[model samples]
Target chain A: VDAGALDAARSRDASLTKPPGSLGQLEDLAIWYAGWRGERPKLEAPQILIFAGNHGVTAQGVSAFPPEVTAQMVANFNAGGAAINQLARCFGARIDVHPITLDRPTGDFTEGPAMTEAELLEALSLGWAAVDPAADLVIAGEMGIGNTTSAAALAAAMFGGNPRDWVGRGTGVDDEGLARKAAAVAAGLARHRGELLDPLEALRRLGGRELAAMAGAIAAARSHRIPVILDGFICTAAAAVLERIAPGALDHAIAGHQSEEPGHARLLGALGKRPVLTLGLRLGEGSGAAVALGVLKAAIACHSGMATFAEAGVADGPG
Target chain B: VDAGALDAARSRDASLTKPPGSLGQLEDLAIWYAGWRGERPKLEAPQILIFAGNHGVTAQGVSAFPPEVTAQMVANFNAGGAAINQLARCFGARIDVHPITLDRPTGDFTEGPAMTEAELLEALSLGWAAVDPAADLVIAGEMGIGNTTSAAALAAAMFGGNPRDWVGRGTGVDDEGLARKAAAVAAGLARHRGELLDPLEALRRLGGRELAAMAGAIAAARSHRIPVILDGFICTAAAAVLERIAPGALDHAIAGHQSEEPGHARLLGALGKRPVLTLGLRLGEGSGAAVALGVLKAAIACHSGMATFAEAGVADGPG
Candidate 1:
């Protein structure tokens, strides 16, 4: 359950062909889990869980667009105008979005946490029910407005580090706005110190219901032995909270990508995991998760299709 | 076609959507020929020609291995360990890989120019005859060792450009190797100047039979009104020579990708076209053209699936 044990398990596999370590990011991901669970790796069937909520912090004028765009974008996702839709078709993956607590029309994000226990429970229930027992992997992503602030608070409460280390200029914020956002995250945690003692309590104190639900979904995926692919900063923070309570929850976790957010690298460093893609992206809403799935697809094909040089009657590198 | 005229035909009413300018690369590719052909815009069943040949220039030690790698790689393509296999599967498009010469093991690139005149005639004959009447577009890609040198020779002789400017490092070559390659291309051209006079003859003199067949294939695709998608420097240069002989040859041209090759940009410029994907890549064997097909699939979906606002009951972007 400890980080040392996790690393030991990841290094357990040295029997794979081609080379001792040639698959790059994929080799680490597969090897990490193979050691933990003692099973040869495969990513044949993957599940994507999208957690949706409305942020209460939009009143700060931090976002270039309105919070209503979150719900509208979710509809666009379901209607299939989005880039992820095409990617899903290419990768042959199923997607389901869980709308928790907040919906449309402008609302105040700084008014403490608007998420209730019921909303959080409902979203978690949907995500849990969606995973088929026959599924091979699980991926978790988040969609919410001013959601970065909530994710920051969640990370602060999960890891005892400073809130400033977790808070970032999400979705392209200017320098002044980012500094103010960091200060806001610290304030939210300071105000909610009493309520956020446990992981669930931390979710109730600083995050939307969807973030709490995502925490539950990740925990469930970990227990079920399904590798959980984390999208970006928000999802990584959610995993941090899940890992705080469960300790070994990240055994099934794969850091899908490192976003352009300054906070993301700090969080990933704490997790001791490196991302596969480094495309300088900070956009959330599962877009990072969407593209990273392509790597999973390639890995799957390599695992399943590539003939060992011995089997193919080819020289091993060069004789 | 003038640049303004090309831009104008792309914006004509009854255009493919969003005034035909919203899809970026896809829109530019489809419109490049709209002005040349004086056609409002129609993309019929496309042809994707994959020409395969082994490079004789591999003897220079610029590559990690010897000339035999060229033949081994062609066999790998047929077997499918490469990236193009997956990209081709994504589109389910027609593909043809012509092996015009078997001189890789012998290391004689200028050896009677792979495909004799009769062979070139037959290869083109068989390539276009395979095109289905339902086809709407065409793409051409080549695989050959020392093919970049051949492409440069064809380009220099036809466009009368400096060979150094037209020579480029194929695959991943160092600066020292690049200089040596430039010299080899120049020497090969001087050794076979007479065959370099006629585009077809120049191809017969210094080019691989696969490159020559690719040129003829593009010419046939133009007559068939099938938009020919050029994979990289080799295919693009072959297309350039064809365009020089017949100015209207570009009527069906579609620049698939701008490769990392030193001369690909110059070739695209002379053809008066731009590529779709500009990722710094020069690996041959049809991978770029195959991946570029996904753009067409996306563009087709956008043109066909975009709701008119009347259909979706949502407001449209201000026209």
Candidate 2:
């Protein structure tokens, strides 16, 4: 972050026609964006990256949808027929689909590692290289059958909690399916116990390819000075690995919304992120973040476009 | 609201590509919009009306800014130089400014009734006539210095509460200013003791022209079948008059954001409204609601634009 730009933006925010700090969190958001971009920044291009990969845990009956739904959703995304596509178009964000070999599902973590070292590295690189260098803002989303179960297992491994605490009904599963999700998470934890100490190893053992890709995309956004908006539980869990490995790794990112998922609020608390919206959004594929982009745009628009009290001939002093 | 349109929209939402209830509150927002508009709704024209008035209570030192700032800011809004203008321009909303006799300040409620019946009726008619009947959505904002003090008093009169419970720092008031606000609210409550039972009487006795105008505009929106996004503290307090007079009078409206004003949360609880955004916005120019318009747009877009499962050739059954 540019300290000088941040200071400059703060000074400018106070001079706007409204009272100082009346805009609340928007003042901080605009200043933060100014720190990354220039003092008078504009959000011209925001990119939405949706990474899709099948999770082998679907075999464990951890999700309500079948594994092939991942590929079908990916095709739907490519054809501009998905929820994320509608959100992206609504917000004028460029949508990109990155499928990390959807035909080849990750290895079942309960039986073994979710991904081999080479496979994890390849997925990460794919995510890193997919980011648009000129984009001013980025949002990484995921589409994977049974991925929420994988996210719960990975979060429990990294953050340390009971499997049931992290598990949620993905795609509207029944009670029996929820129990299977918890059991699979517990088994994955037991299988990858020692390896969980290292965040990267834990991610490789329990997180899916799309999850790894989201982590990579978030890191890549930081390098490009593009502010990132973290989506729901699966996306946040993916990015959590980076924060665990290095403190302040996600300083460039903010949680987009607190989803209806049980573990999302806890994960956001651990990350020390206050979500921009709390609309009870639970769908993945970056829909929440895409929706939140409008807020960031409004913040920037007001910060940059509104005239100062001096310019507007408006009084700005206490009575 | 059209019941048939709402039911049809709900069924259509279930058949969308995403899982049921995955979009959370967004699904409900879209359905509500459809109920007001039709089975397929489009938010092409969102109208924002900003009513500005002066208050005699400024003599009591209840607010941080002077009364002249209201007219000055109203001019700024007219010149398209204020925060609300920026937001309206960003979201494609038509901005209308209604200065309800800004030259004549309302009588101080601490001494006597804020307005006579004729004055109250004139303000209400101005607000009622200001709303464009063709607008699909409407937002009412205000620019009245010392109006928060009036809001607190009116809220206390409508909903039983101590003066201190409803008072907050309006536009960054000092501790001394806050004390004056509470005292003013207490004085007004005592002065308007017996005649506060009727909601309209309470509004006339304690509320300013801008507040009464907001109430009128909200009531007018309901008659026109236009959905409304209620703004922050002062706006909500203004609209509460209608809701108090007739239960469910605010069914056409949803809170746009929870303001930083201390009384807003308590008022929202009484009204049974959950704000769409909780960004701590305390700016009363309908800026929060203008920003939330994007979220509403996204909800309607996803609800009306996404391909259904069978339409998109995607399987949709429990595993």
Each model's TM-score?
Answer: 0.65, 0.99
In candidate 1, what are the lDDT values of residues B190-278, reduced to their tens digit?
A: 66766667777766555666666677667766666556667888877776767777786676667766777778888788778867655
Off by over 4 Å in 1: A1-44, A61-86, A103-109, A114-130, A145-206, A228-288, A291-295, A308-319, B1-48, B58-83, B103-133, B136-139, B145-206, B215-283, B288-303, B306-319
Question: Candidate 2: deviation at residue B67, Å?
Answer: 0.7
Model 1, residue A277: distance off in Å is 6.9
Lowest summed lDDT window (length 10), candidate 2 chain A: A310-319
The global Cα lDDT (0 to 1) of model 2 is 0.92
- The 10 consecutive residues of candidate 1 chain A with the worst lDDT sum are A13-22
TM-score of chain B of each: 0.79, 0.99
- Per-model fnat list: 0.02, 0.83
Candidate 1 global TM-score: 0.65
- On residues B53-110, what C-alpha lDDT tens digit does candidate 2 reach at each position? 9998889998878888999999899999898998998788999999988889999999
DockQ in order: 0.08, 0.79
Q: Write the per-residue lDDT of candidate 2 for residues A1-319, one digit (tens) a residue.
A: 8899999999999999998899999888999999999888999899999999988888899888888788888989999888899889887899989988888999999999999999999999989998999999999999999999999998999899899999998789999989999999999999887889998998899999999999999999999999999999999999999999999999999888999999999899989999999988888999999998989989999999999999998889864
Please tell me which predicted candidate would have the highest lDDT against the true structure: 2
Candidate 2 has a TM-score of 0.99
Error of 1 at B243 (Å): 7.9
